[model samples]
Target: MHKAGIPLPNDQVNADDVKAVQAMSEKLWKMDLAEQRVALAVLISLCDCIVWWTQRHK
Candidate 1:
């Protein structure tokens, strides 16, 4: 018999997250040289902030 308090299994991934990733990839692919450079810079900045916040809590 199944336990009363146990959580059920999730059989499918979220489609919206998948779609966002796909859209980002497509944008990166279609970006011009200048746009690509700016996009990369923004991504690096965001990553740095994330890392800093994570380290601060430790």
Candidate 2:
């Protein structure tokens, strides 16, 4: 079973939660354009406060 989203009711957050999200997001990125588009639509619908960052490589 997957436990990837939201804060636990017990108020415990783990590094694994962050890692799971990162892994899932990376997997979503590697999906086909059509699949990614669908995933993005779902993601946008679920967001309240969206934050993103970019790093340019030299």
Candidate 3:
């Protein structure tokens, strides 16, 4: 995809990206349902805190 003749770099891949995929594949995505639910709740709370902090700073 391009905007104003500048192409998006969606095809880019780096070592960190590869490692993150491998880690998630070996851990989070392989978790049982109950464990996954707990993980999801934690992620939600973390995101909420992030948003709150950003808004407070702004």
1, model 3: CA deviation in Å?
39
Each model's lDDT comes to: 0.62, 0.51, 0.62
Residue 49 in model 2: lDDT: 28
Tell me the spans in candidate 2 whose CA falls farther than 4 Å from its real position. 1-16, 41-58
- Quote each prediction's TM-score: 0.52, 0.36, 0.55
Candidate 3 residue 55 Cα shift, in angstroms, is 0.4
Ranking according to lDDT, highest score first:
3, 1, 2
Q: Candidate 1's C-alpha lDDT?
A: 0.62
lDDT of 3 at 50: 100
> For residues 19-48, what per-residue lDDT tens digits would candidate 2 score against the true structure?
766766666566567655665566786562
After superposition, the stretches of candidate 1 with alpha carbons farther than 4 Å from their true spots are 1-27
What are the per-residue Cα lDDT tens digits for candidate 1 across 5-58? 322222344577887667656655665666566656766999999999999999
Error of 3 at 31 (Å): 0.9
Best-fitting candidate, scored by TM-score = 3
Q: Candidate 3 residues 1-58, lDDT tens each?
A: 1343422223334667987657656665565666666656766999999999999999
Of 1 and 2, the candidate ranking higher by lDDT? 1
Cα deviation of 31 in candidate 2 (Å)? 0.5
